[model samples]
Structure formats: structure tokens, C-alpha cells
Target: MTIIKFLTLTLGATAFLSAQSSPIRSCGKPLHPKTIVQNDAPSGTVSKENKIQVALLLDTSNSMDGLIDQAKSRLWNIVNTLTTLKYNGKAPQVEIALYEYGNDGLQDENFIRQVTPLTQDLDLVSEKLFALKTNGGSEYCGAVIRDASMNLNWDGNEKSMKLIYIAGNEPFDQGRINYKETISKAKSKNIYTNTIFCGDRSEGIQSFWQSGATIGDGKYFNIDSDKKVIYIETPYDVKISEYNSKLNDTYVYYGSRGSEYKNKQMVQDKNAEVQSASSSVERTVAKSRKNAYKNDHWDLVDRAEKDADFISKVKESELPADLKGKSKEEIKKAVAEKSAQRGQIQKEIEVLSKKRQGYIDTEMKKRGNPEADDLGKAIENSVLELAKKKGYSI
Candidate 1:
């Protein structure tokens, strides 16, 4: 099939004037500034444990509503995929950062905004993602790619799998920054820049989306952004959901925003459920893996697990109402009980999740298992392929 690459260059006279002005409408909260830390460790040594760092740069243009919906639905599934990976017989720490570009609601010159920095707090990531809104704006592929590469904290471990996935329908070479140069810089930092074009394969190739991936030594994929994500129902889903509810009851909140963070966890649960039962199940499965789902910032059980002196050092006022009046010894015992209960509940969910996966796999084979051409599948395929090349195993 013949491909047509359209490069439209229309420089509005207002571009320069509006560059210094605020956005006409609010995009979200102010972007937090982060210092860029480069990984300088030698490639042959293991100074620190391996980690998986992924940055998602999405286009929130007026016509990309379907793409956003697919991302929301597939997030938990993506998380589940990561949980299955192991490096040197141990699960690596997973951090995800989010960025939204090609939206006029943003005040930046490139119309790009960082939704969240690379973080282990999955709930915060979910919260920021759901808050994104689309607006008609110029898509600057090169500029956003450059920002994500230079801003977020990327580890320098040679064995670490660091990736940047940028999805959009615009020409890959647009904007003031050249994609080739930006992507080359990313490669020097051991970051692969994957490109997902929300259109036909030929069109994506012609538009230079494929080139973006090639330049950064990463994968290029084309997806039908308008396609609806379908989920297969399994009999094990209901039981898993019940166990997930019991698991939620095992968390002990602490800190100033302890109650608020706990509420956010439930809110993210509802958000996942809103996507589909399959998504909710995927999230519960992710939560069951202690290696992937961690809430040390707010949950006393997780905090104590990481820091032995946390209980003794924590002020009583920071504890939840139920534990505020209790002595440190009593608090420690309570946290221990909750941790033990959480561990057992997690095991039950993990077993059920395995059965659930088996059922889904069998059903898929019966139906010929057509490939899903969406945001999640694109990332999953590329991640596994690149991760294996980095000497990691799934």
C-alpha cells in the first residue's frame, strides 16, 4: 500500500505572543520541577538493584478521546504485565511517569505538561491520568520527547529497562526541537524511545513515527485509536474481587494525609471498576504482588516493613483515630497483625489470579486469540522484547 506523509507547517502569528501568556483554560495543577539525575554506573557492574522506568507521553488533542480511554482501561493490565517480570530472581522496582501534550489547555510553549514525575505511587498516577482533558492544539512530538528525557529521574543502571513511549497522530518531526536529536540524547542515556502512531501503519511510517523509534533503538507500532477494548469474562473474577475487598481492609493508615491517601486508594479502585470488571481484576492482581504494589508513603504496615524504626519514631498525632491513643508497643503489634493478614490475603488473590489467567488464556486460544492493537498491547509487546535484551526474565 502506498503511504502519504503530510507535513503541515502553519505558523500562527500569535505563537510568539502567546508563548509567554498563560493557557486560556486550565489543564491541571502546576507542574512540579524535578532535577534530572543521570545514571553514570558502569555497564558491567551491579552497584544497585535493577529497576523498570517507563514514561508515557500521550497526545490529548481534540480527536484523541479514544486513545485516552484505551490508556485508562489498559493501565492495570500493563501494571500486571510488569509484575510478572523478574530480574536475577527478584522483581525490580517499577516507576512510571506521565505526560500529556498536544493540548491547548496547557500554557507551555510546546503545549506539553508533565502530569506526574516518575513515581512508585500508582494511585497518584491514576488520579492525574483521570484528570487529563483534551483540547485542540498543535502537537509537538519532538518537544515533549526532549522534556521527558531531560526532566524525570532516570536511573543509570545498565541492566535497568528505561523507556519512553510517545503516542500521537501528528508528524513526528514537528515543533522547534528535532526528534532525531532528542531521541539520540535519550539513547545516550540508555533510554529507548518507542513511538505509537494512532493511525494506519503506512501512514505512521510515512509520517516519520517509525523513524522516531529507529533513531532511539526502540519499537514502532501503529494502533487504531478509535477501537474499543474488549475484555473476556472469567468465572474466577467474582471470587478475586471479594478477596481484594478483604485485602483492602488489612491496610493501616498513618501520616498527616493517611486517611486521604487511603480514600484515594478506594477511589482508584472505583476508577478501575468503572473501566470494566476485567480491569478491576487486573488491578487487584497487581496489588497482590508485594513487589509491584507498595504504599510505604501512607500505609503503616508498608512503612514499618521498610523501616524498622518507623513505629517508634512516628508521632502519635499522625496515627489514625483507632490507633492514636495506643502505645508504641500496641501500635507495633497492630501493624504486625495487619501485615500478616495482608500477606495471607495477598496469597489468596495471587492463587485466584493465576487461575483467572489460565481461564482467559484457554478461552483466547479457543477463539484464535486475535491481537489487540491498542495502547496497552503495544507497550506490553515492546517492553517484554526490550526487557529480555537487557538480560531480564519474565
Candidate 2:
């Protein structure tokens, strides 16, 4: 893409990103900010790189109609907002999945519906969300927790963090499965959950839902309004592969500190203050694909790869922050170089990762997860294997 185009997209995407900004630190401060109490990355405070898995658990109860209506209207805003993180990636790579409940919890058989599996494809999530019609019963937070932990593909890479978000109007308590077991399983595996309360807590179901969140080692927030619920967030690990080229400066700062945020407590909130930001979504016109949301990243993959040179240029430029009327040639050179290097690193990582995955695929064919195909158990061992390889203390 041309320089003019890139700048335009970055400017457009920032408004949306402000809402999902991590609460871990105020989007305040220079790249290196002073904290209330400096918690260093040493002592296993954070991970050098970030890998994230985000799941959305929805409430399909009869009363959630208006909430769902607003969801369709504003879903794209969230995606546009997240595009701001593209600076670090061959493209800003964020993978999100969705789940909805309330389809007959009163019956003894099925209560959960897997609208879309965990995916990088955002359109699948959007389609399912739009298709969602409220006509189910017995919304139970515990079921969603258990089902995701047991069935969803939760990536437990040592360099990454796995997050599950459960949103509903009903309390999570009262389910057939052991509620404590559901929460305990998630906590033990480092898969955190965030609960968005949809009903009136004062009416008394609040305590039950809160307790469920406590056991799951997750945070629960009450959403009284549409805007508040749609943007729910928690501190999540973002991979080196997702930052956009336009964000070269921001990427360099955060990439350096990624190791620190790795193990630290990542926090998220429904509302956040926006900081200086930009994303390329506005530059190029999104194509006329049937499932446009999922295809959002299609052409962008090339754009991300082109940034490999840019990544390296930025690393070397050591561009002094105070550009007092610098020449255009100098800035363009730095930008091009940084973009190329970022794309190159992403390419190399992809090669190594694919080679490694090929080895695992072969092994899995022979061993079948080193445990039963059980989701929770499979995730547990996956974490062990990844941590062992990464030289991290689990």
C-alpha cells in the first residue's frame, strides 16, 4: 500500500482501539512509563512475546434481544478498533471465537451451542452473532466454562495467553456439571474467564454469578448498557506477529517490554481510555467478500509481509523522537526498512513454527494428545509441552 493509504487507515482505526486498550497500564506514559510501583519483568513478571486466544460466550436467553441487536450494529467497530494492534504483525493478528447458550438447559441433554470455533476468521463470528435469535432457556455460566475448557481449542503456548469471555444475563451457578470443577479446571490450566453480567444483580442472582467467576479465576463485570457490554476486555497477551507497520514506533516499545507483561497479571475492562494510535483498516477498501469479516485479513497478509523491511529499518533508525523538520527521504527510508524487517521476522517465525507443527502433527497421529482426546486434559499437556520447550518454569 502507498504511504498515503497506510496513514489514512491508521487514523481511522484508532477510535475503536481505545475501547479495548489493556488496563494493565494506563495507555498513559511514553513507550516506557513510570508505574506506581515498578514491577520488573525479571522474577518472571511477564513474557517476552505474547500469544493470545480470545473466546466470546454469549447469552441467547429470551430477554437478551436488545443486547444482541446492538451487538450486530457495533461488532465491526470492535474489529476496526483491534486493527490498531497491526503494527507488530506481518499484520495485527488477533484470533477470536464465539459461543452462545440458552437452547434448552432445562432439558437433560444440550445447553451450549458452538456458533463459531476459535478462529482468526472474524466473519464466522459475525455471521453467527447476526444469526443468533433468543429462544433458549436455563442460561448457566458454568456450562459455557466447562464446554469451552473441555472442547474449545485453547492454545496454551508458553509465549501466549489463553482467555475465555462468558457474557450472559443469567447467573452461572445452577448447572448439572459441578460448577466448582468447571472453574477449577480453567484456573489450573491458566485459561482465564471474564464474566459480563446482563441481569439486575440487585435482584439476587448476582452473588451466584460472582461466586462462579471467583472459582474460575476470572473477573465478572456487570453491563447495564449496550456500549458497556460489547467492549468487555481483560489484559491479554498479543503476539509479536500482530502489530501493523504503521505502528513501527509503538511496536518497538511494546515488543521490548513484551517479556515483562508475559507473566504479569493482565487486566481488561469494558471501558478504557484511548491513547495515540493508528491502524491501516481505513486505507484500503475492504473487498466485497460474502463473509467479509472473516476475510478481513486476507489481502492484509501481503501488506503485513511487506513490512518485514520496515521492522528492521525502525530497529536501526534509532529515530530520535523529536523530529525537528527532518527530511522526507530520511523518514521514508526508516519506514521502508522497518516494514521489511518486521515482515521478514514474521516469515521466519512462520517457517519455524510450521516445521515444529509438522513434527507435532506426526506425533499426535502416533500418540493422540499424550492423553485421551479430552479437551481439558489435552490442553493441560499442551501447556506442559510448550513450557518445557520454551525453558519456562510452569
The candidate that achieves the highest lDDT relative to the unseen native structure: 1
Q: Worst lDDT window (10 residues) for model 1?
A: 6-15
The numbered model that scores best in TM-score is 1
For model 1, the stretches where C-alpha displacement exceeds 4 angstroms are: 1-48
lDDT of 1 by residue, 1-394 (tens): 0000000000000000001111123233323301112232222121137677778889999988888888888877777766555566556677777789999888888898877777778787778887878888999888888888887778767777788888989888888999999999889988899888998889899999999999999989898888887687999999988887888898988878889889989999999899888888888887777655678888888889889899999999898889988999999999999999988887788778778878876876888855435777677667767766766554
TM-score against native, each model: 0.87, 0.47
- Candidate 1: clashing pairs of residues: 39-156
Q: How well does candidate 1 match the true structure, expressed as C-alpha RMSD?
A: 9.6
Candidate 2's residue-wise lDDT over 301-344, tens digit each? 22233354433333323333432245645655544565465445
Error in Å for residue 384 of model 1: 1.2
TM-score of 2: 0.47
User: Model 1 Cα displacement at 70 (Å)?
Assistant: 0.3
For every candidate, C-alpha RMSD to the true structure in Å:
9.6, 19.1
lDDT of 2 at 387: 29
Error of 1 at 31 (Å): 15
Give candidate 1's whole-model lDDT: 0.74
